[model samples]
Target: MEVTLLLEATENAFRIMEKARAHALGVLDTAVQFTGEQTRFMEEKRWQVLFAGAQRRKTRFQNFVGTALILFAFWMLLSGHFDPFHLTLGAICCIITAYLFHDLLFANVRVGDMRVVALRFLCYIPWLIQQIVLSNLHVASVVLRRKMPINPQIITFKTKLETDISSITLANSITLTPGTITMDIRDGVYYVHALDQKVADDLNAGEMEDRVAHIFMEADHLYVEDVLDAARIYDALRV
Candidate 1:
């Protein structure tokens, strides 16, 4: 009887030890799975961060290159010197200027098609030149008048232009004309000194503002002519 009881007790002890061992192995496996999932999550987050940083760097590089090229082209156009020494000097100056002020040129670059903007700007130059000539003649006529009807007056108008660059361009264009000067720009309002009432009326007509807005792709209202011009520009580019 005593030997039977001892055998029963030994069997019970062995069963308990086996169950404990199985439970420990199951817990270990669960821990290993959780650790692997955490590692993968961290790796994915790291890759995402790296990719975003790379994209930002790429955009900045493109902007810098574009700015440098534009500066160089403008320098060449203005200097009109094709000699190697002058070319090299101008290139250096443009590179330096672009490095210093690239952000200013591209600050309000909202449109993806920079080529379109450039073409539009080039087209605008001729129109601006024509306006300047017409303005000169008008000013000349005013000066040659027997009474010299020089009625200089300050006119203020709120501009619809969106960007700082566009505003500056408008201001400079006004100053470049014979009878108007951009006196101050305060809170989107332009204070201009016009040599006569006719000059003020011409500015109030908003043709110049509309053209500037079209060039920058920031027009609030598009005209039929603007749409046709844009279509023609796109067709020319495709060819």
Candidate 2:
């Protein structure tokens, strides 16, 4: 009789432990599912806020910049430094340009990307630094040589820039370099006039392409700035 009683007690304990284990696992699974749902929800909300904020800030900045440009034109008009109509027209042009390239001349506006356009100019500051350093050395070599070793030539090269902005930026950067002046841009490729063989070599280096790519990267679009595509004439036309 006692043996049977003990067996019944042991069976009850085993059943209780199994039920406890299953309940704990169920609780853990529920917690994990809840955390995943919450994480996704938060991420979606964060991106929505970020995009909306950028739009608002961009619009406001454009308007403020536009107003400043227009005001400067007004100041020019008040100074009576020439044709008032021309001044007015110039101001209008400035406003239009600002609206077109909002980052350069205007602020906070939903107009076209002025930031990338601005970046092109900002990038020149560094390029100018390089130019100052390089041109001096280049000029010294020519001066020290008994006969001028400079072999000035104009060469054409194609770029891989997909957007008009990036292509323009790359062209401007080339021109800003002491030895390389961009004479023209055909389609997306640039025709560069080099002061010497060294200039031609630098143009061939593709370093400028990488820098321009970095500038475009700061702006928020891929389609307009990637100059690394193999198909672009810039990549194919290196002389």
Off by over 4 Å in 1: 1-49, 71-105, 220-239
Q: What is the C-alpha RMSD of each candidate to the true structure, in Å?
A: 22.5, 21.7
Local distance difference test scores for all models: 0.76, 0.64
In candidate 2, stretches whose alpha carbon ends up further than 4 angstroms from where it belongs are: 1-124, 218-239
| Tens-digit lDDT track of model 2 for 101-178 | 665543222344556657765855776678757877777877898998878898887666566566766777676666
Best by lDDT: 1
Candidate 2's TM-score: 0.44
- Worst 10 contiguous positions by lDDT, candidate 2: 104-113
